[model samples]
Target: MPIGDRDLDGIIDVENSRLLSTYRKFGVVAVKGKGSYLWDAGGRRFLDFMGGYGVAIVGHSRREVIDAIEDQAERLIICHNTLYNPTRAKFLEELFKVVPRNMSAAYMANSGAEAIEAAIKIAVKATGRSLFVAAKGSYHGKTIGALSLTWGPRYKEHFSKLLLDVHFVEYGDPKSLEDAPLEDAAAIFLEPVQGEAGVRIPTREFMTSAERRCRKAGCLLVIDEIQSGLGRTGRMWAHEHWGISPDVMTIGKGIAGGIPMGVTVVSSDYADVLRLGEHTSTFGGNPLASAAAAAVLRVIEEEDLARNAERMGHRFSRGLEGLEGRFRIPREHRGLGLMAALDMRLRIQEVIPRMISNGLISTYSGLRTLRFLPPLIVDEDDIDTSISILDTTFGAIEREKRSM
Candidate 1:
């Protein structure tokens, strides 16, 4: 069912010839999108369970977001970061209202990594400490400061000298923090749910306990909500689930509905730590990105996407549960809200092709977990369709293996 640009293979060939070899493209060519589905180059539509790494919360081809972009582009698309912009201000105002308690300001950046860079700078400046704490299997971003916080060996091995002293702790274990030398650390950063680490969830008690420890020891609490925030976890912010607010919050991914944007929101006490010109981004608060973000925010609130995400996530989980081995996959499913990962113990790399053939899109992650981040705009019917396809294929695998 692929459409557009002659044929699917044609586009693949074109991409191979024209694009850089460093990046890989899936075999399918996405021609267009709407709601929870994307049409391939041959016009075959598949449910986007991956949701572009959980960025399109309102789904693809959203009218308001497109219109906002169109309108902004027609007016003023490119502007320097040195000056203030109305659209940026509007986004910040709306952002401040929904940001967790005590978050007083925001510093906009171009992506999640940039946001982390800003966050690390803020923590170091506020506390006058060089060290920060991050958890094993936690993903912050790929930039230097963010990469320092990222504990994956694949992501951090080559640049050992470039990275800083970010103590690694066991995720979901507050006792790790309790045992650490928190007094000298600048900040403790974590994701409410580890997305790249295969949708692992930290215990709420562990998170709250760490917050207490940070408070007592003068360590800053910085949450990398780039993936878990913005309704992926059903809650608007994943940290809200633990009832603890951070001194600084970094948000990206779905924040601007597929646009390149990230923001570091701060509490009042630490808001002004970075003075004027202390930290500035060239494309941070441009009008067009802000306009896109504003529209995305409105749609999220109007549609009550968080509620939808919560409801649909449970339905997806229940639909897939109790079949880890039955499906011939060894996954134990875990995640919060719509951000679910099915941890498969099998080599299982071929599951994705079989899934694509059955009209679904997903990706594998840490622990061999296949991550599912269906857009917030996805409905019950889409969920049902996806499960039906998944159920059929998984059952077939199990049956074929048993016969063998």
Candidate 2:
């Protein structure tokens, strides 16, 4: 509103009046962010546990990211896919080092959904199959190929007619996958940590067995690390902890330090499957996005955010467990590293608005899980502050129930 310098009062009012109501936005209009805090138009500060939906792994408005964006903006922004871009090439070269050895090449996309599409294309092309097998309660993305693999009845009921054939077996069970006749299947998609399905952590045995079975059956293995990637879970990539490397992997959300970027890395064997003109994106490998992504990776590496996340995550998990003793409503606390979720008896209908009113925000994996995804750079004091806010809010709800 005022040269993007903390004046959102007038901007939000005008936006509400004219823009479409797709998202149920919070009342406060955030103007700026740095480290793990954000300020609204009224200069109200919020300890950003959300982190742009787990996008700001290295923290908000990081100097490195800002510098990269500025440098790229001055140089060149967008160009067609027909020509090569310097930043994009550099980003890919850096990306290849962190990925599994099997994954040799990558395709850049503008968002997670596009990466999902690319993964789907690679998997299908590799195996020459049309059917996909996924787990129930897994969220790949909102695009057609991704949504096809998603297994929520409520979300898919309206779009049933528009979906494709995706067989979903129970999550955290490898027998279902092993027993299946998968000769005609393209890939078996799994999210190492089921972010939307309540941060469900599966056993390493389950994942390893699933990978073995998929490989044995000649079906490509695709892991969606969109929400769980880039040190959110104490690892460069979430799949690394499982000891199973996917033939193809999708990464986004935190790839570019809150800037927009998505990636689909594939093994060299399957990488060449996608023809020159088969799939392409206009903004997929833009200098601005790739430059930001490179900066994000550099920050995560230089700061050793992965190790920090592991240490802080254990501390936070223990703290949460202590709180659970007092509250006793949430059924479980689970996740890896900084990515954690609580299985709450309180449904989303009641808990969401309550948390928001208390000057805090949380996420729901299903109707039950209250997800806690603090930034990787979030300090111990901020963790304490967030827990205090939640404890106060939960106590109020308990008091109201007692009165009722």
Candidate 3:
């Protein structure tokens, strides 16, 4: 039961005994990470493709983020929102410069779920409506309020009784939203690019139509950019791709350069829904997280990581598509920028582990899709390396299947 750099299996056993049984983890016990690579406890190196579920956009252990956090930790860490702090003020000022023009105010929190919860409350208080609508296959979060808006039977079945009144329509179909009863709904929650549901990108026409419909119905359009925002999709915001403005937007994951933070950016008209005392978080806009966020914004601007994501993502997608006929199942690529996925005809549960064994770490969105959220800082060489590893893994799997 010793915990000092034990074997992978031993560490996993120790984790099982001590941690809650909520996560399905891989065997690798990551000890360190830096810029698209992770080292296991055994000193084995892995080319990271998951990016900690898109939380490492600026790259793991970025120097700017580390320096900012250290500096802020030495100066100040937490201060109640009652008092105005310089770090928090600077972070908010910089944040406003990057978000959508319609979004003039922000509510900072600790995670994506908290941002979603705040958006829900804001929508309810603003419109005085009790019902909500979301797209099918959408994933907002797992918290009580967020989960109610999330549309997945598996995640909601056990906690069905605790959810609220939420109606779901087919994603990427404008007619579905038009057919739903959204006139009386408080808000319509959507992801610019559905991440957990396998990096589904909607059509520009569909997005514009949904925006028009929501405006006509007087329902707040809440765009959840938790996984797709912050330059992950080659733009400051994924909704920018469609040229549509949302009433409220929830962002997290990589907003603070891997530090945990969530922000609900709201339009100026609806910003006053949550009164001063109605909604507040003790650590929402603390100095450390705000400092990290300010540093993240600077890094994204200085490094031009969003443009890199666009170029690398296109190259990676083409490489994946090139392997279409070489495997037992055809590989179809879909996504924008660094948030990409390969839709395989077969379940990728075993294939992902094989890729990990080959020193390339990845994740699967569902039974038949391998999702890739490589760091935005990745270069052409990194993309090539990942593609090469995938080619070998797919070839080996095909050979094994043929032998059987």
Query: After best superposition, candidate 3 residue 277: deviation in angstroms?
Result: 1.4
Decreasing TM-score order of the candidates? 3, 1, 2
Residues 18-94 of candidate 3 have per-residue lDDT tens digits of: 89998878778999999999999888899999998889998899999999999999999988899889999999998
- Model 3 lDDT at residue 125: 93
Question: What global local distance difference test value does model 1 have?
Answer: 0.85
Q: In order, what lDDT does every prediction score?
A: 0.85, 0.83, 0.90
Whole-model lDDT for model 3 versus the true structure? Answer: 0.90
Q: Indicate the worst ten consecutive residues by lDDT in candidate 3.
A: 1-10
Q: What TM value does model 1 have?
A: 0.95
Where does model 1 exceed 4 Å of error? Answer: 1-4, 17-25
Among residues 3 or more apart in sequence or in different chains, the pairs in candidate 3 whose N, CA or C atoms overlap within 3 Å are none
**TM-score of every candidate:** 0.95, 0.94, 0.98
lDDT of 2: 0.83
Measured with C-alpha atoms, the lDDT of residue 25 in candidate 2 is 67
Q: Roughly what TM-score does model 2 have, to 2 decimal places?
A: 0.94
Off by over 4 Å in 2: 1-17
Residue 159, candidate 1: C-alpha displacement in angstroms: 1.1
User: Which prediction has more favorable TM-score, 2 or 3?
Assistant: 3
Q: Which candidate's lDDT is highest?
A: 3
